[model samples]
Target: MRIIKKLGNAFEFFKGTIAINLAVSILPLLFGGLLLFNYSVVSFGFAISLAVKEINSKKEYLFYFNNGLSKGALWFYSWCFNFILLISGIFIFNLINRLF
Candidate 1:
């Protein structure tokens, strides 16, 4: 239950950025960056800055900050949520490949 709420909170904050997150996270697998397996780490760092500066206006940033979630925590959750999706996508892609 707690995890679900956390995910909900993060999802609400990050819903707009999902596509961006997916594009960046997949870049690792794209350019051979997967050799070191740093997809989540890179995405997490990218999300912290992207969430703050790229996603929305300053007013919204403060809105999140004022809502009791520290910037770091919010971004961390954003990263976690996106990474889970990324991993699941990879799994499904592989499954489909094997099926065909």
Candidate 2:
């Protein structure tokens, strides 16, 4: 239950982040669904997009800062989320291709 709630909170924090979602989804498709080799682009895109979004909204930056999450941590999470998802998705895709 606690884990679910924490995930929900994280999702909410990244609500307006569309670029990351688009990059992760489209780039993999464009690259033959094999994006592990280019996961850095996805991660960097997420970090930059999130930083731009937060910078544009001072209230958001302050909110997170006041709530104990620094900007660095937010960016780290953004990058990690996209990078890990890209790696996992590509790995699974390759595995399925090999098995089937």
Candidate 3:
């Protein structure tokens, strides 16, 4: 019975951790995406800064921080992907213009 209780507690902890991580990852991306779409660098910086502050302030909040970080990273990567696409398009446009 004691072992079963311990297992249950451990499982609960694991579940909570997963939930926190997921939440942290999502929140940043949502805000970041909105800011990106609007080309609001100030808002993006503010949002990410707040997230970093929150992550650093509370050790117990580490799970949430990690989740947020994951989301932020995803947002950053997506932005990078878009930037690369734009550059490629510009290069192709220039090449075509020069050729014609």
Q: Report lDDT (Cα) of residue 64, candidate 3.
A: 34
The per-model lDDT (C-alpha) reads 0.62, 0.61, 0.44
lDDT score, candidate 1: 0.62
**Model 3 agreement with the true structure over 1-100: per-residue lDDT tens digits:** 7545534443333333333333444555476653343343224433444455446545534553344434444334434443454366558877999999
* Candidate closer to the true structure by TM-score (higher is better), 1 or 2: 1
Clashing pairs in 2: none
Candidate 1 residues 1-100, lDDT tens each?
Answer: 7667656666776675665555555656566665333564345535654754544555565766666666677777766766676577679978999999
What TM-score does candidate 1 get on C-alpha atoms?
0.63
Q: Which pairs of residues have clashing backbones in candidate 1? A: none
List candidate 1 segments past 4 Å from native: 1-6, 23-55
lDDT per residue, candidate 2, 9-96, as tens digits? 4555665564555654465557654444365356545655676686777687677666566667656665666566667767898899
- Could you tell which candidate, 1 or 3, scores higher by lDDT? 1
Candidate 2 lDDT score relative to the true structure: 0.61
- Which 10 successive residues of model 2 have the least lDDT summed? 32-41
In candidate 3 the C-alpha lDDT for residue 26 amounts to 54
